[model samples]
Target chain A: MKCNRTDIDTETRLELEGALDALTAPEIRPIFDKVVTDGRKRVTVDIHKVTMIDSSGIGAIVSLFKRIKAEGGQVLVIGARDQPLAVFKLLKLDRVFGL
Target chain B: MNAETKPSDAGEPTVTHVTFRLRASLAHRSLAIGLVSTLVEHVKSADRDFRNAITTAFGEAFNNVVIHGYRNRTDGMLDVEAELGSDHMTLRLIDDGVQADLSSVTPPDLSTLPEGGLGIFMIHALVDEVVYDSGTRNVLSLTKRT
Candidate 1:
């Protein structure tokens, strides 16, 4: 998986590509940690390039969302399609994450 | 991959059975999922939703075996058998790792926005039936019908 981070004003945009499964989730842990520690006010996660996603991939995003929200920050997840979108809808996270 | 086609009656749909084995680890998870996805494409090539459901459920099941059953250990192996027919598909995953307590798994409350527990839930929701048995080896069967 490839994770790229960009900061614009107070928002942090994360562009994720490739399969975001168990094997790749750990590789992006540092990005998740930085987003939380930095306490960005707005974070946008783009998963359009993510071909597949499992529970572990979802966990990474949910963990980041929870921590950011706990600190009064906002997170927006955009560009979810195919298998990843199906999973998000199945877990009812589409509405929660405003996908 | 070993595949065979079963002869059927005049009106019965022919069933194609395929089986393969892989190392039970995250590294091989995508390979396993991709094999199943290809099988699904061969059977129901045009239905994107069907392909997505099968692949997603199969991926989660594989993840469960590697993460929960093997406890992240990579020395084990996973055997997968897929039965594909005209209107349905069934995937059986066999493993000798730690047996999962199927009774203890429950759907996570989406209101809580929990993350870790959705694996089993996704496997159950995306398929028509899920059957799990633990004996000399653990077998998990997931079936989906159109």
Candidate 2:
């Protein structure tokens, strides 16, 4: 998977493409962690190009959501599709993320 | 050359072969699913039982390899192969990664509600048989009988 970082003022947007699975979760984790540490109040993760997600990928997203939410920040996932979207729906994370 | 054929072998049933070579990374999981689903759909009528069980098992096994075996490495390729027969289907996944000692790796105790440890258990539960061979490479083989 490929990830691009875009920061504009207070919102940090992480745009992701390709498959978010076990192999690529680590590459994106540190960025989310840093955003949380930087005290960003609103983070937008763009998954427009993402085509699939598995448990590990879901775990990574969940970890980021938890961390950012703990700091009273909001995390929004945009443009999730196919299996990744099914997973979020299955786990009821859609309600949690308000996506 | 196109017309040359063995008449005796013509009566034998044809077996479907499917293969995919994808870089062992999280982003390829969707590709794997798409490929596997196509195979399942192709053989569903002939081998519904095997198709159902194997489709679930493949999801779990492929997910495990893509997630745990590759872990942080996104450079290696994962080779996936599946064969459909009259009575059964078999899936073989090959990956180059740090092979965990299958002997040393104990099955996670499922009674405790461990979060990440349920993958293997779920794989075992979904398929008729599951095998893991750890050596220079990690190869997972799963089979189901229809």
Best by TM-score: 1
Error (Å) of candidate 1 at residue B118 is 1.2
Tens-place lDDT per residue, model 2, B79-100, is: 8877665555667888887675
Q: Rate the local accuracy (lDDT) of all candidates.
A: 0.89, 0.68
Interface RMSD list for the candidates: 0.8, 5.0
Shift of residue B47 alpha carbon in model 1, Å: 1.4
Each prediction's TM-score versus the true structure:
0.96, 0.58
Model 1 lDDT tens row, A1-99: 999999999999999999999899999878999989987979999999999999889999999999999999988899999889988888888998898
Model 1, residue pairs in steric clash: none
Q: Give the TM-score of candidate 1.
A: 0.96
Candidate 1: lDDT of B10? Answer: 97
Per-residue lDDT tens digits of candidate 1, residues B1-82? 8999999989988999999998998889889988988898657533888889989989988988998899957698999999
TM-score of chain A of each: 0.98, 0.93
How far off is residue B12 in model 2, in Å? 13
Off by more than 4 A, model 2 = B1-41, B44-59, B63-81, B85-146
